[model samples]
Target: MAKGKLVGKKLILLGERDGIPGPVMEACLKDSGADIVFSVTECFV
Candidate 1:
């Protein structure tokens, strides 16, 4: 597994679902070892 240091950074993921990430997006972020601070989804508009 690839690993890196993420001490004080913010990650904002905006999508259509909650607690579920898209495959491609997940893979890219996983490779970078980012610390996800926020994950949000839009319900309408």
Candidate 2:
């Protein structure tokens, strides 16, 4: 992803268990200059 694309923004990530997890997504976006409100990993099975 482009750096700082989410700069000065707030994020609420909803991730999947089989796909990218919340923490992983959070890590990837950590350098995006965004404030993560929360990250949730949901399981659908």
Largest TM-score belongs to which candidate? 2
Q: Which residue pairs clash within candidate 2?
A: none
Candidate 1: where are CA atoms >4 Å away?
Answer: 1-9, 17-28
For each candidate, give its TM-score against the true structure: 0.41, 0.83
lDDT of 1 at 26: 47
Candidate 2 structure lDDT: 0.91
Every candidate's lDDT:
0.56, 0.91
Candidate no. 2 TM-score: 0.83
Against the true structure, whose lDDT is highest? 2
lDDT of 2 by residue, 1-45 (tens): 446568889999999999999999999888888999999999989
RMSD of each: 5.2, 2.9
